[model samples]
Target chain A: MATTTTPAATPGRTKGTGKPAGPPGRRPRRSLLPYLLLAPAVVLELAIHVIPMLVGAWMSLLELTQFHIRDWSGAPFVGLDNYRVVLDVNSAAGAELLRSFRVTVIYTVLSVGLSWVLGTTAAVLLQRPFRGRAVLRALFLTPYALPVYTAVITWTFLFQRDTGLVNHVLVDQLNLLDDRPFWLIGDNSFVALLIVSIWRTWPFAFLCIMAGLQNIPDELYEAAAMDGAGFWRRLRAVTLPMLRPVNLVLLLVLFLWTFNDFNTPYVLFGGSAPAEADLISLHIYRSSFQTWDFGTGSAMSVALLLFLLLVTAGYLLLTNRRRNDA
Target chain B: MRETATERWTRRIVLTLLAGFVLVPLYVMVSSAIKPLQDVQAAFTWWPRRPTLQAFVDMWSTVPLGRYLINSLLVASVAAIFSVAVAIFAAYAVSRYRFRGRQVFSVTVLSTQMFPGILFLLPLFLIYVNLGNATGIALYASRTGLIITYLTFSLPFSIWMLVGYFDSIPRGLDEAAQVDGAGPLRTLFQVVLPAAVPGVVAVTVYAFMTAWGEVLFASVLTNENSRTLAVGLQGYSTQFNVYWNQVMAASLVVSVPVVAGFLALQRYFVAGLTAGAVK
Candidate 1:
């Protein structure tokens, strides 16, 4: 793993030929040149991003309710009926589709906010040099690195009704509960997903925050400390404002990523009786694959895309405004 | 910088407790994997009564654990190799270039990261289905298709992160090379990249881990044939009776190597993480 990376990065570290491209025409060249430079990434995004979305948009308009497409000509062009079926509470699909959207919103907000605070706290505390910090830092990232399925499975096992470790400790050792607490399988799907999701996502927040914290020069704090200000004051006065941009970006990313995440809720609840727990992602999975309703599934996906596109546009606008203000 | 006694104490206590909190789930995974089935059935123990490798043995016998491990390793390694190579060039282009639409491109790239993978699923699945039908050369329901999908997720962040590292590299080095008659290409390769070794290592460990641990598309796109470790473990739920010990053992197999990877790539991983190597 270590070796594979070095060769790509070690391209031109040797002695150089000295005929420089002068600064004269550099300004004009740079204007068009950077666009050329970013051409590959734009092209890749077009392939991965624009094309699939266009395909989905087009597909959503077609009436292909079943899995296998047969009689395409006979299939009516039912424009937005699929969407109305999805949104109308009277319809079979609307109830679950709307439920999923509500749950997704709540889950995304809570998960992202909690993860950010925890991440920010950890990053702040671990910012300065300390003994055993290196090892602790690695441990901090463990949950994020533990793939979703593995973490979910482990969490489910720990939360099991009778023979789970959490129950043993909470009930047997400390007598925290009279009976085994229903952690994963209970009335509150919201609580269960929140616990596991927060635990798993904090590492991402940690990475973003710690990275930002490191870049904050020690001298800023030194100057503050010399003035006899406490840690909280310094953090509030200095750290928070400086980290605003990175935090915004991180928060935006987390909300979208966690919102789209399909597997976490699926692994925990398995589209079971408590339909309130179903997220939009899981709804898409079940609609398209399990129930074999591709048209409605494709419509839900288009809705998701619009919501995301709007969020991205808002975030970009805010960040760009901040950049301009700065 | 200054710490009060209360501050010091709270920090120490929270650190210790949080560390313990983090270790509990992992400890449960390890202990349950080693516990005997009868012991497991009776109750959860902080330490099992008679720890045995019975669960591991059973897990190996029952599921195709070895196949899943090999399949996951192959896909992750290949993706890491190809994606990092591509990420370096792509990151280079984004970071160094000062052209028109640069901001739009950067925003677009970041925006793609925000694009929900869920929305793309049905469309990508349909495309894969068509691929399988039209050409016998379909990458669908296989490692190849999965790798391509994983790369789409991996590439945006990798490029963004590489751009971050590129920004930190002093333009002086590149300019010095240019002054000494090197082209922009040579300058980027010779000067900019080697200085960013830590960043590259960071990207590798990150991309590898992302592929290694994700279950969303892995479970959806491929069925039983090319199942990865995460999907392999999910199979334990199929039987009406939950195989607690075996399932725990299977999870252990997945977590151990990744935890080991985290341990092995410590400084580079942590540094790169801060430097935007992983996200």
Candidate 2:
């Protein structure tokens, strides 16, 4: 009976023994110690990310503003009314909000996709370091580290219809354009933004994938080569598998960044006018900071926050499942 | 024992051609930055004929380039220090202890990177305004605010990287230390700290590069005194005219460190890139 009773206890003990016993009676509290170390970072990130999200959510429920400095009190609750105003077209705010979302998605998807392909290709090219490889790698990072205002301004100069390098090439040199195409005007507005977009962003993928490439073991390649694997075959089998985590991380990062991207687009295509190129960040700037419609701008922020939350949640779910498989 | 002629030729041709493609815009930028404005405006010239440093001269006197550079250096350094310091402890925790919230904490940090800055911009803007209003002292337009914000975004990556570095550190060292009666902190300081120097350096360099290069928050958050080199570049475009030569010069100015850092630590950066990545 005693042996059987002890044997019954073994299952729980065995499973528990697989993991170490953390500080007794201090499991929750012991964990809090690390968190205490983590407190400053948490507090800053909260102030930056979480609290604003909550506030935006809260603001969506109320008429929130910092327009006139004095009062700053919350108006009586109007549940989902801001969201209604945002989504409904008859309402001006709704039309603007809809515009913002449309532009935001376009910016996000294109920025993420184009940059990913370019960066990945660059990383692949860079997997081996030969002569001048070091210099070339350094050279490639220029687009990334160059100040946005400068790069955009440079883009602005390049895309300027007349007396621009691009126009000089397209019209005068190659004769691609009979007359200089107005690259920053109506039709070419977003196209100009896209050039700046690709130029500025492709480096992100380069950084992420470069990091990913480093993680792949030379031994794996050697073994595969010993088995007579080709370069493409090796990349497909070994490199891609190793790069999965960084790729996912980069995807999420690029998506979020492109979605929120303000500076490059804004500088290239100014906040006012250029509606074709204006992203949500620019739109929000127009509404809140420019138009001073605090309630609606806050609503737009809330909506944007929700969209980001969904994307991030989806990314997490996918990556988590992927890790589970591995 | 060696590559075939085909391999050598193919590598040479591909690499040389790609280098040309990469160098074109960069060459244009450098050429333009040194050229007189009229020369830049004229036909495409690979080499700026009669190259002068007039644009660089103009770039300095026209804007707060010196101040912005100082601001960038200061903010980047402070953010780097704060990021690395905070990261070391947090990274140690996440790596060493498999606590209940370990997974949650890591996920939170990773997810923080994916959260758009726009989501935080408005509320944080108000928060800063209020801080200014309340204390009669402000962080928003001050150098301090820039450092704070940079660290917030930067810490997560640094921490994430450091944690991966920490995991690679042999736990046997800790085991031996524990057997010899050294405490956890002692083990970390004596064993892990020395080993983690290279990674810590990489993280610091990364943090500096990020803070130095960042523009968005720098623009919105600090408009007046705390202008970054990036924000200062925007000054080239005024109400009526854009200073193309000067702007290109400024862009060249900003890219120096990232290029230099990569060159200086090319070996380490490549190595660290793969480090802390794989399980």
Candidate 3:
């Protein structure tokens, strides 16, 4: 995993080059070029990611609000106060944050789970060549290909109560429900958000899993079949095991992307998501931008970042350990 | 391992179901765009009753769609081009050279992908404001600011993927070029780049699509004049009503370039994206 993830860490292998290594100081002039080439990316990464992260951590300690925004440095220091307010479950802000956190957890889990399942299902089913398979594969990837805003905005329209196709199918056609529930607002907004999220993300899972499927040689399946392993048994023994590495990375990527997703909820529900469907990203956005409480917002943002870092670290560690065990 | 009739039917059924799920929103968008405003505002219809292209015409005038489009194009294009250029150099260095801090650089860039954009939003906003005040260069509510902010969003992935892509091009090529007195820069541009064009295109499309679809930053960063389509498209729905037809029309228009580009380069994009995970 480390070797694959870090391309630079792997020593370059020169093909057909029998030449011995040059003297250590032979290429002094060329040494500077790498640094020169790297300077722009390094500088931009610092400005865009590193510096702002440090500043964000700093801002988390200050009572930065609309009042102090113009001259944020002058904002009074309030170390841990923002964190306390947001993390204390008894407090309104904290309670709301907790609710949003729970919602996000549920949303991420369900979205990731459903997307992976759908993606794997579609990929496995379409693994073998069939009629119109090319068209179907291309069609399946359309959602992922479409811009996030365009796709979600279209969803917002589809989720509309009075004129929505979702309700029309469920109520008018399928007779699954008597009432045409308000999808973009109230409690159902969460469900609406989840649907759009699954719709948007499942295609990516499909693509990744499909690519992974190609790497699994047919001999594995043929061997499984020689052992009298049926379709379900063959899939379990051959397909899933071979796809483990891809799944490990795919699941983690999906988890991170879906967990931190802001676009789908923000666009589907507009800027201010309903409490029932408030993701932490939008919650933090509303905390700072809407309420002008940059301090608390930054605190929440820092917390979210820390939580994600922990999850990613834990995920990588666990996967690496499991791989070692295998 | 030949599938039985039952298995064949099951595959077809599942595929059809999944395809419907995938196509419904797209079908709705295309069908709704042609519907009359009243028809779209009323009960949903499987097909448009009164088909018209009025929404397509009205979309441009409804908001400053043209201005927003231009802003999106400029921001996304410049960001993509700059990101690709910077990434090519950095990727080359990382791929070909094992200098000090290379691992740290690669890891730092890769780890940035794990951080949420919201984490940067508040502080970046403040930095822009404070920097603007102190340095007399406006970053808040400015296109320049947005572009600068958006650079890192795709930089890490671009670098990571390009490194993988560049790693595939044999070192023999670079060694041969170097032996012939071609410098690293000349080898990269003339030798490696031509071979890595597909990877560059994939990265460009990814970066462009990212910038195009970005909502969180553009929401906070850009004002009306500088608003990209991601934020500006919300104008279609004011306090009074939502122009659903026109919104759909505009969505189709906005999505065409990206969707088409993505599908066209689907093979390379998939290969580049999955290289890290699969390998």
Candidate 4:
């Protein structure tokens, strides 16, 4: 193999990987090429996402109350006061924030768990090829493909207490309830939000798990079958073990999405989410925009970010350890 | 192996029921959108009996539906193009060169996904206000501003998807390009990118679809002149009296492009998704 050295290629990287040839025609000085190529993306990410995140942490320290919002620099610097406000369990607002956080945790668990169960069941069922399977796959994925606002908006109408199809079927058709339960209000609002969340997300799980399922070798199943293993046994022994990597990634992603989700609940519940179904995301949004308390909102958000980062890091460490053990 | 009749029947029955569960809300959406107000609230009819375009017409008359669509399309399209363009360079560098901080860079990109968009909103809002005050660039209430925000949210995922895609393209192509005297940039454009067409389409669709449907930022960031379809649709609900037919109709209208795009580019989309995660 004729090895053509890349002018700006890393000193130690171009060895032993059996990589292909470098592209032709290098500028005489190519040491800066990679940086040049990467600059725009790096700048944008830092400016928009990274820097703003740090700035949010700083703003969380300042008392960016409603009046000072126009001129945020003039906002009083009250170090950790906003965080104290959120964490102060004795205070009503603090208690409410804690309650919303609990609701968010429950929401995330139910939403992720149900979506994963449904998605996995569907993926495994559809793994065995059959006629019209392609159409069925497409049908299953339709919810995920549709716009979030549109899908959730439809769910809002569907969950309306008076005219909703959900109550019509559950109450009128099935006689499951004595009355049309208030789905879009009261404690049932959580159920309503969960239904919309699960509907929108499961299809993604299905798609990912299906892709994972395709990678498993049929021989493993056949071998298990020959050993007198039943379907469940075969799945446990062959499919589940084989799919651990995909499942870990899928579950983590699903958790992250469900935890951070703002759109579904926002659209479903409108601005002021029912106290029972008030998710932390909506709660934070209300704190900042609706109530014009940016400092407290930023503090809650910072708390949320730190919690998520811890979970993510822990998840990664657990998965990496498992991989090494395997 | 021969299939058993019982097994086949069971699979069919289960699939059909699941499909119904999946399709019912979509059915309700379409069925309610075309139905008149009387039909919508009258009873639980699965299909519209007296289907009319009146709801669509009413929605258009009441709201700037056309302008909302145009604005959304413009924002989504530009956001997708810019995000994908910037992502290509980063993805290419990561895929082709094993430089210092490469792993850190890739990990950072993945970590960005963990930070919720709301985390950026307040500070970005403040920055926008401050920057606009200092230098009159109108970053808060403009389509350009909204697009930039979308780009921020979309870039990490796009770059992640593209990196996976570029990794899949054989290193031999670059080798061949080098032999032919093409530079890294040319090889990426001429050899690697064309070969990774599915990834490009997937990234484009992903970014476009995200920007198209994004609501939280759009609701807070854009003004009436620059309001997107998502924000515009919210108007129907915020009013004292929500017109169910109009909301349904408007929801359908907003969904058409995203659904159509997903269907048209599904293969690439699936490939991108699966590749990004599973690998």
Candidate 1 docking class:
medium
Where in model 1 is the C-alpha error above 4 Å? A1-44, A67-75, A270-273, A315-326, B175-188, B263-279
Candidate 3 lDDT tens digits, B63-96: 9999999999999999889999999999999988
Error of 1 at A250 (Å): 1.6
lDDT of 1 at A280: 81
Candidate 4, residues A76-189, lDDT tens digits: the string is 999999999898988877999899989999999999999998898888889887778888888888898788888988898898887889988998888999978898889899
Compute the lDDT of residue A37 as modeled in candidate 1. 48
Segments of candidate 3 deviating more than 4 angstroms = A1-30
Candidate with the greatest DockQ versus the true structure = 3
Fraction of reference contacts reproduced per prediction? 0.54, 0.42, 0.69, 0.57
RMSD versus native structure for model 3: 5.4
Clashing pairs in 2: A86-A94, A215-B274
- Model 1 C-alpha lDDT per residue in residues B1-279, reported as the tens digit of each score: 567899778778877876886788888888888888787777777787888888888887677888888889988888877777777877777777755566776666767777767666767777776778778756678998887777666777777777778877877766565545456666677788899887787787778888897777787788677888867876676646677789888887777777777666656654654656233
Better of 2 and 3 by DockQ: 3
TM-score, predicted candidate 3 vs. hidden true structure: 0.94
For residues A201-308, what per-residue lDDT tens digits would candidate 1 score against the true structure? 888898778777766787888988989879888989889977876787788778888888777787776444256567788778777877766777888888888887
Q: Score chain A of each prediction against the true chain A by TM-score and list the results.
A: 0.82, 0.83, 0.89, 0.89
RMSD of 2: 7.7
Query: In TM-score terms, which candidate is top?
Result: 3
List TM-scores for all candidates, in order.
0.88, 0.86, 0.94, 0.93
Q: Write the per-residue lDDT of candidate 2 for residues A136-230, one digit (tens) a residue.
A: 77766667766566667777777777667778777788887677788887868877787678878887688779878876778998988888887
Query: Which scores better on lDDT, 1 or 2?
Result: 1
How would the candidate models be sorted by TM-score, starting from the highest?
A: 3, 4, 1, 2
